[model samples]
Target: MRYESIVRNTEFSRAYRRGKSYVSPFLVTYVLRRKRGGVRLGITTSKKIGGAVQRVRARRVIREAYYAMGLNEEQSVDLVFVARTATTRVKMQKVEKAMRAHLTAAGLLSR
Candidate 1:
């Protein structure tokens, strides 16, 4: 299924300021519970990671991995995945694993 995306600057800022965060070699995740709406996701890749191509690849990998998780829920939450340098080189499964770990830590996923 497709995900509702976190598109506004305010939405992203709110998650960063109030969310619980988890870090892995491949990704950094920030999660916040929302009062209403479905799950909204954001993937961030910066110039520190690489040039345009690498940045795009990182976002794509994170998106695909997130999609594979099937974390659909009626409960509203915002998840932000920040791509690290390693994210560009790693396979999608690794990214997915990292994401699962973070979400689990945040209690978005079951143990």
Candidate 2:
């Protein structure tokens, strides 16, 4: 959905602490809360990934893949996508696959 909803969540801090799960190749964490009526997504890249450009690129890649996969809006899912060092040089497909796999595992994706 819109970036504002994802960025301005009041319960993000608590949700972050309570619901944190990881998967191979990336760290998948999320908090499902009752919000307006849709899902908002956030992407995070630490310095471990790289400098500003690298971090920005990582965010852009994930955001692009998320949009490309038509998963920009999800109901009740506040997602935080963290990129690991391995993702720095990887292609968008891998990132998309990892994200999709995680989403599927989380039961957010249907078939």
Candidate 3:
């Protein structure tokens, strides 16, 4: 199932305040359980990652990695993926792997 985007500032803040986080070299992931059905995804790339081009690239890579995971639509969760500076240079596979690892650890992945 296609996941929805978490687009509001409040949504991001909610995830930050209530979520469990996992960090890797390329990404920091926050996962929060939601009462709503289906998953919502949010991605952020800070200035520390680089200039606009680099930051946008980081967001693109993170979004791609998340789409590759094929998460179940039946699950209810809010996921925020924050890009690290290292993310600008990492391959998509590495990003995807890091995401999968975190989701698995969080018990969001069914296996």
RMSD of each: 0.9, 2.5, 1.0
In the range 17-87, model 2's lDDT, one tens digit per residue, is 76656565744556454557577677777798989988887888888768766754647666777777777
Instruction: State, as a TM-score between 0 and 1, how close model 1 is to the true structure.
Output: 0.95
lDDT tens digits, residue span 1-111, model 1: 767888898989899999999999999999999888788889888899999999999999999998898896776898999999999999999999999999888877887
| lDDT at residue 66 of model 3 (Cα atoms) | 83
| Candidate 3 lDDT by residue in tens digits, 14-96 | 99999999999899999999887889999998899999999999999998888888887888999999999999998999999
Clashing pairs in 1: none
Q: Where does the lowest 10-residue lDDT sum fall in candidate 3?
A: 66-75
Instruction: Give the Cα lDDT of each candidate.
Output: 0.91, 0.70, 0.92
Predicted structure 2: lDDT: 0.70
> Which of the two, 1 or 2, has more lDDT?
1
